[model samples]
Target chain A: MTADFLLSRYPYVLIAVLFAIGLYGMTVKRNLMKKIIGMTIFQTSIYLFFIQGATKQGATIPVLDPELGPSAELYINPLPQVIVLTAIVVGVAITGVALSLILVLYRRYGTLDEVELLRRMRESA
Target chain B: MTSRFESIFLFVVARAMVPLIQVFAFYVITHGHYSPGGGFQGGVMLAASIILLRISLGEESYDRFPREAGIVIGGFGALAFALLGFASMAFGGNFLEYALAVPGMGAEELRYWGIFFAEVFIGFLVWGALVAIYDALESGGVE
Candidate 1:
């Protein structure tokens, strides 16, 4: 594709690549930490998607600037920013809770390797 | 599987990039109302930044994560949001009725303040929670 076409679609391409990498790691990695990394990457890509979607050509800052002439023709939408804020908080809370669970799992299994840990848990349980 | 070189280059780079990304994330969070970025995207970026740091440094280095400050930050964000909501009530409007809360404030100003407070909550939560999760895995691995 030409550069112009590429620029227009680049965000989606980035999002797709991010998703692919994350999914591959999550599915194939034997380490629990690796899997978590994958998940985080996956989640982050979605955030990127939302941010990109909200952006439009030639949009101005939502903040009112005195420098802009009284008849300036543009202002950006602030709604997406508001939505993303809540999503970020929830992601953090979920991360905390997930980490706690992982800790518990570790205490029980004595290992961080996901496959080995799972095997041990099966045996013990 | 990748070699240590790959890990050092890619993974370590990931780690190093996180803090920078996080600074940008904060910028995005605060400036979001005017730009394409917003609270959710910025918050996630913040979490991802720290998560990258953990990945590159390994879990042991997570002691660098600030627990108390994170908790306080998150609490403050939520508190700020609550206060914004309640400000409307105090100003003889329904809760979260930004338009009625302040006669002197423009409608846009009230909206911005309300949104900013909400975004602050997200920022704190993202910072606090991501570190917490990383801690969970790190502690899990070490023991």
Candidate 2:
């Protein structure tokens, strides 16, 4: 795309770039810890994308105001924020679980390297 | 690990800060209904306080919270939330219908209390569960 197009949709471009970086980390990293970091990055990009969607061009927050009254057009979408909130907790919970499992794996194999871990598993079996 | 030497400076600073953190966490939980924060955010704060203590003071830091207390508190919070729903149902109301849970109280007041209690329980559950997870990760006693 042209510079103008990219500049006009900077948030989207940023989201795409973040998504790519996260994907790269997840797929190309050797250490399991790095992969987890990549996974967290990927998740962050998705969250940012949702947050971007939740905003409106001219609308304000979802909170009610006496002057603004109860007009739907005056407020930004609230559902996406709620969704992101719940998703964040779930993400953290899963991340904790994943980290604990990784801890156990390292305890057993004595290595965080993905390839080394696989090799050790085979040797033990 | 538990074998690591304890730092007096770390312990003293963490001990001093833990109370402030917990107080703020309580404020966040209680004022959540009218503000941006709610149960999860406050609960995470509580867990973070514990984590700070754990990092600085080591195993002995768990004296206040304890390892087993995490799951117990979390389970109690979960049970409270569930009971709130069932209690409403027992009053011949649909699930979570707080207005019906109380026979004569106004609908608005009942609903407010219901949501408030829900937030409280949610905060407790999140705080305890997160602490438990952190403990598990730290211990890694999966023989």
Candidate that would win on TM-score: 2
Q: What CAPRI class is candidate 1? A: acceptable
Each candidate's TM vs. the true structure?
Answer: 0.56, 0.91
Which residue pairs of candidate 2 clash?
A: none
lDDT of 2 by residue, A4-59 (tens): 99899999999999999999999999999999999999999999999999888889
Model 2 DockQ (Cα-based)? 0.64
Off by over 4 Å in 2: B3-8
The per-residue C-alpha lDDT of model 2 at residue B140 equals 64
In the range B1-143, model 2's lDDT, one tens digit per residue, is 56324677777788799999999999999987767788888999998998887887777777766889988988999999999988889888888887454567788989889988988999999999988998888886767
Q: Report, for candidate 1, the interface RMSD.
A: 3.2
User: Per-residue lDDT for B76-105 in model 1, tens only?
Assistant: 666776777787788787877765546688
Highest-lDDT candidate? 2
